[model samples]
Target: MFKSILVAVDGSEIGHRALEEALAVARVMDASVHAIHVVQTGTYPTLILSELEPPDIAQQALLDALDREANEFLADAEREAAAAGIRMTVYKRWGHPGAEITALAQELGADLTVVGSHGRGRLDRFFLGSVSSYVVDHATSTVMVVRG
Candidate 1:
């Protein structure tokens, strides 16, 4: 039984579904919920926007945008959790989603971590990698991958 549940939210439909599932499980177990959003900054600092010819994309500005987006996602997650009658502590950080989620879950003593499967094809996963897959393989706590 999970006493504390952690959910990774990306603001995607699948991610929202996973959050809902986490809330349901938390309700059943009377567990606390921790909702987190990680803004993946990848190699943006060194990479250029090929689409933009000049590629003058200010790395700092781009990072700021990502942070803003993450904050919005976390805010929405908090609202959803509130509507579900579940009190959830929301966190937003900039880093690798998988690693950050796992580390935070462990730090919070979460017994279970919930994530959504992006349904990426093998080829796509090979090139882009999968955060859910990484979290599932690396997390120390029990991980539930919600697929739709």
Candidate 2:
């Protein structure tokens, strides 16, 4: 009986699946879907985007690129939701993914927040940290973790 659904997307396959699940639920419950993609502007970005060059690179440039990418990802998610006859609102924020997502959900008064887990092992998560785990533990709303 969710009236408002919040789905977190990171342009990953698991994230896509989570959005699909959110859409299905929204369709059944006649709920509004809100999607968010965080630009990840802290230390976590180093671990998350290891492929990128060192931190010595231009910080502003990197953030701009990340914001553009986040917008593209959100646009794609919006298109998919629109195709299903669902009007989804998407947002882009710059911060720790978990914190931003949780804050947005609270701000929107979301009834449910859906996130995708990368399914990294405990050891890896312990070292690199897990955004999904953080969101699951910190979010006030009901949470659904779509694992991959």
Stretches off by above 4 angstroms in model 2 are 44-57, 119-129
The local lDDT score (0 to 100) that residue 22 gets in candidate 2 is 99
Q: Any residue pairs clashing in model 1, and if so which? A: none
The global C-alpha lDDT for each of the candidates, from Candidate 1 onward, is: 0.83, 0.85
**Tens digits of per-residue lDDT for model 1, 1-148:** 8999999888777888999999999999999999998876563554334555643448656766777888888899999889989999998877677889999998999999999887223442465438888988999989999886
Residue 19, candidate 1: Cα error in Å is 0.5
**Backbone clashes per model, in order?**
0, 0
Candidate number of the best lDDT: 2
Candidate 2 to truth, TM: 0.84
Q: Which segments of model 1 are wrong by more than 4 Å? A: 43-57, 119-129
- My TM-score estimates for the predictions, one after another, are 0.84, 0.84
